[model samples]
Target: MKLILVVVLTTAIAAIGITLSLILSQRQAARDRALSIISGNKLQDATGKPSDKNDPNKRRAALARKLKESEQEEKDDKKKKEKGKSTMRELIQQAGFDFPVSYYYILSIVSAAAFTIGAFSLGFPRIVIAMISIIGFFGFPRLVLFLLTKRRQKKFLEDFADALEAMMRLLKAGMPMNEAVKMCAKEFEGPIGEEMSRIYELQKIGTPLGEAAVLVAKRMPIPEMRMFATGLLIQQQTGSSLSDILGNLAKVIRSRFQLKRKVKALSAEAKSSAGIIAAMPPLVALGLNTFNPGYIDIIFETRSGHIGLACFGLWMFTGMVIMWKMSNFKV
Candidate 1:
């Protein structure tokens, strides 16, 4: 029995040592392979590749990699477009416009018809009226939507800081987030209130705070709101001091709002100048028609005159756009 026990012990020891050695060797091999790759010494075919098959395989691999990259890029671009669409939809909602996505197309058709008719009635040639119609069809809706949405977004941003402050106070009082949002929805007015109402509905539907944050960020698409949502989500996930986090964020947002006001004050003159310049051409034409009655009648009476007016209008619009972009401050 003693001899049998000794034999068994010896065999167990041998097995353990073999397994340990194998594990150590494998770890060492892995480290070596990693080091080799890092040092730009990746292992190559040991059999000195069958040249023809090797080249073909390498080419195929490269092509596959490029195809994968292009596909990934396409997916990223598509995601960007979807993100833009979402923000644009939200902007329209904020502006109290119930227009469907198809509204732009319908408006474009109407605008084209209207511009064609108006220009033709003014004695413009068919070709000139057609060009103006095309421009109006493409541009009028975009311009109107842009101006309305920008104004609404500005109003929302102004009021949004107040909402954040209200929320911070409620949170500090130990009110639950959904309850705080509900209060804000009830007490606040305008775009911010409507947005909070949506949040309350989302919360009532049992959406997780993290996912809700992402949703709100997508809808609002503003830096302050996004920061607030991100803070809420992180606090939810990591169990942080919600009140303190929100309080600090609210302070920061208010400070940003003040800075924006100061910037607006400083840039007010430039913005006014840009606006006046943009308005000058139309205003001058209106004044000339009112005062002189037949001044620039040739512009509407002859084909050459029509061509000149169209060219001048195009250049004036381009200049207006450039001035507006330059005068505008993103913040």
Candidate 2:
């Protein structure tokens, strides 16, 4: 009994010593955790190395970087959207339409409404009227704009060559670069003078010559204008004979114009053939309707007839588009 009591007492003291050591280690660990949080440092492990995986500071920094990147991406997306929107507006402006976009929308709506009423008054079915209205609203406006834009671009191209020639002449006469541009603007008429005056005005406002050239190039988007702008900027940056460069560019422009005319002349027969093919069915139907009343009325008079006409129209448009594409030859 006395030996058992001695062993029990020794075991109790050992257990107490172990418990005290554990409590002291727990308190030390708590103090270390507090200091780590305060100093913005990672908690060190038993090997005396910082554990980045479990570090709050590192996690916070990573999150901050991600947030910054996301913000930058949003800004870039916004810029792209704005640029696209502005590009369309610029095209409309370049086409010489000074009206607001809302004007076109209102015009389209009014046109659709008027066409629907007109078609209904002509005893057309609802589906036929709908088709007519859609064509009036969308197709007509687009066709008009397309024609106008092409005409304006053609006029610009014709005048641009002359302007380049005039610039070369002025440069040969020993006029300063800016003065030469001003003289060209005053000497020309139509789109060339207008565009050159715009460039001169931009220069007056302290826009750099290269930036001004780039702006006009983007506005017109013609290869000759782009080449001219690039050549001028390059020659301005390096020492080069401005007159010689302008004269060569003018010659190239005239050659390209001549080539374009030749191509158009060569393709005229194909274009005329396609147009005749596309127009034959409608023209024949009109002739038949005139000679034999109600002969073509079945096309839009009954539901089956409406469906047939729809399919026929679709195929006819497809064939016409194919022929048009085949007739086109790029320079």
Candidate 3:
């Protein structure tokens, strides 16, 4: 048990240290790349004689600046929306739950009570039981919420392009944007259907189509969803062809989905290795306790041993989180 604890702690600390170093290195590399790009652009501009209004370099610089401005505006908009809503409410909405936030509180209370009772029945020490209860109350519910939100988002993304194509076909059939959205709400199922229904409902309640799209984007907060909303907003403002915009957006989404799959496939081996490495210490300890009697008693019987075990578990959790973040690609 002692050996297992030490191994887990050492591995976790080392993994965390490595993760931090990699993050710092990546940031520094990004900064260097940005600086290099800026310097290269400046050098090219200096070497070239001032050209007419059709200068490609100037056009490129202006485009880049506009892109940056648009990105900053999007960021500010997201921040404002986030700030206006409660985090828990947003999480619940993302998880597809329509219950009030009070339900979450009730669920947490029940979880904490159940955990406390189970720990007591198992003969755990008071401090250990308290820690478990606290985790049940706070950590477990949030973890569940995160998992649900992620699963819902993944499902939405998987079917999103298809939804867009459906909507595009409706538009091409001479249906107005509102009718197309309403048809999508009825035609699809799962996250896409639910979100489309929401948008349709908002529109029915006298909300502008653009505002409804914005609200849907706010709820989902995914890039693809935002792109869809932006497309709607642009079409409304500029009188562009909605069918063409939806078709292009659908293509882009499909491309992004393909890239994500490729990245996940490439990272599968690393993720599997991390999972195995993380499970080994606990499995070894369980084996020792089962086959070699009293091998883990020290960890349960002594306060100092218990503290060490807790620290070991905490670090192990930290390491797993860091590894998960490392393996996950935002694209």
Candidate 4:
């Protein structure tokens, strides 16, 4: 009877605690909602205020000024949207693989399926089959995608200087900034042009220029594009000459590109030496295995062999990372 009473008491205490927790959570949620509503109202009040006037001539002048400001604001907005659209397109292209998260899930499923099949078909050890599946389905695909994305981005950066020069020439010819961008989109081929074309279209369809530029900057993941977008946004806000600003930007970009090339050239020998040194160990191990099978088999035929292999892989990876860091230069 006493034990039953204790159990009942425990259950009641837990239920009370749970109920209190739920009540507190509900109160917190309500408070958050109220705060959100208050903030939203403040934003609407600031952005949606109405213009007021008392006299006819004054009203006319006020209306004209308001209209002009609205038009300029609209143009700025269109440019921003165009920039955004272009950026998203560039990111997709440069990454070389769409839907990385989805790809990982797919690869996981594929690896599991391959592992199951290998275990059943060849009578391989479960661990070996698992390793094979992991390497073939997940590891190899990830490696390939990484390499491809890197190469694609490199190509885009290499081409960026020329594209900027072309746009600068068009700007010098007294073409409007938007028109010059469109001309570049039409003239250049590849990722840069493709991104520019998207921006051009977005600007044409009434997207805000500032918003478009922000979008483009976000998508490209390039420092130069980000810098350009920021400069353009500031210029638009301050009513600066777009052509002269872009010309100076073009010069800066060109100089940076040249500097990057020089850095790469200077580091090429060190990079090459690192690669050769990294390869030597593996090649020497292979030669030893080929020349003396029994001697090599002793190390690789036991659990200790697996441990050694894992250690070797770790060492190699660490070395490669260090070498890459040494070689990499930012401008």
TM-scores of the models, in the given order?
0.60, 0.64, 0.72, 0.61
Q: What is the lDDT of residue 222 in candidate 1?
A: 63
lDDT of 4: 0.64
lDDT of 2 by residue, 1-331 (tens): 5564565556556555655665566656644543343234233444666454535565455434533543574477478767765544555666767688778768878888888889999999888998999998987776777777778779988877788888888887888777888887898877787778778888999997656876776566565776677666545544346776677778777877888899888889999998888889899998999999997788878866765675567567656655665566444
**Descending-lDDT candidate ranking:** 3, 2, 1, 4
Better of 1 and 4 by TM-score: 4
Count the clashes in each prediction: 0, 0, 0, 28
TM-score of 1: 0.60
| Model 1 local distance difference test score | 0.68
Q: Report lDDT per candidate.
A: 0.68, 0.70, 0.79, 0.64
Return the candidate ranking by TM-score, descending: 3, 2, 4, 1
Off by over 4 Å in 4: 1-93, 96-125, 301-313
lDDT of 4 by residue, 1-331 (tens): 5664575556556655655665566656644543342222111122354223223344344434533553584477578767764433334445644564555557667766876686769888878887877677767655655676667667777777777777778877887778988988888777778778878888999876666776665456566775576556545544445665566667777777798899999999999999999999889989988998677786677866765665566557656766776687656
1 against 2, candidate with superior lDDT = 2
Candidate 3: pairs in clash: none
Greater lDDT among 1 and 4 belongs to 1
RMSD of each: 26.6, 28.3, 7.6, 16.1
Candidate 3 versus the native: TM-score? 0.72
RMSD of 1: 26.6
Question: In terms of TM-score, how similar is model 4 to the real structure?
Answer: 0.61
